[model samples]
Target: ADGYDSGGSDEREFADAWLMRAHGHNAVDLDEIDAAEDALQETQFLLDDFAGLIDDFESQGGSARDLFEIVRQVVNNKKTEAGETN
Candidate 1:
């Protein structure tokens, strides 16, 4: 592409940083790499749904904070179901 660095080093660095932050380390086995890829894919799927919901809600004049509160409540309810406190 006809972009910034021309060598794409910047894009590689950004991807490396993102992957490191997501998986916590660069030294991992093949299985771990597979697991991380699976987890990331699943998270992307969830984020697509979450983003859609946020867009729909905002389109209706709803506050993003309200969506966050709903997520918090869901987390708390799950914890309660699992006998977790606080």
Candidate 2:
């Protein structure tokens, strides 16, 4: 119901049609969006921590590319689960 008139079409019929279309597709949920944002933020924090670890590994003369790749994949998976695209 919140997004029912989001289209803001000047034509009444078009606005009504937009509302119908929103209902047909299920309107966006604000709570879900907030949850997704929270998840993404968490993923970012994880990435930051991994970045620090990678830097430490590299400083110790360890090849960190592989470790970085693994971390990248895990972070990507977390983002995907959060409904985000890289």
Give the number of the best model, judged by TM-score: 1
Identify the leading candidate in terms of lDDT: 1
What are the per-residue Cα lDDT tens digits for candidate 2 across 1-86?
77645444467778678798878678778999999999999999999998898899989898887876887999999999999986
Q: TM-score for each prediction?
A: 0.47, 0.45
Cα lDDT tens digits, model 1, 1-86, are: 55544358897898878888988664558998899999999999999999998999999999999889998999999999999999
TM-score, structure 2 vs. true: 0.45
Error of 1 at 21 (Å): 32
Question: How many clashes show up per model?
Answer: 0, 0
Show model 1 residue runs off by greater than 4 Å: 1-29, 77-83
- Candidates in order: C-alpha RMSD to true structure: 14.7, 12.6
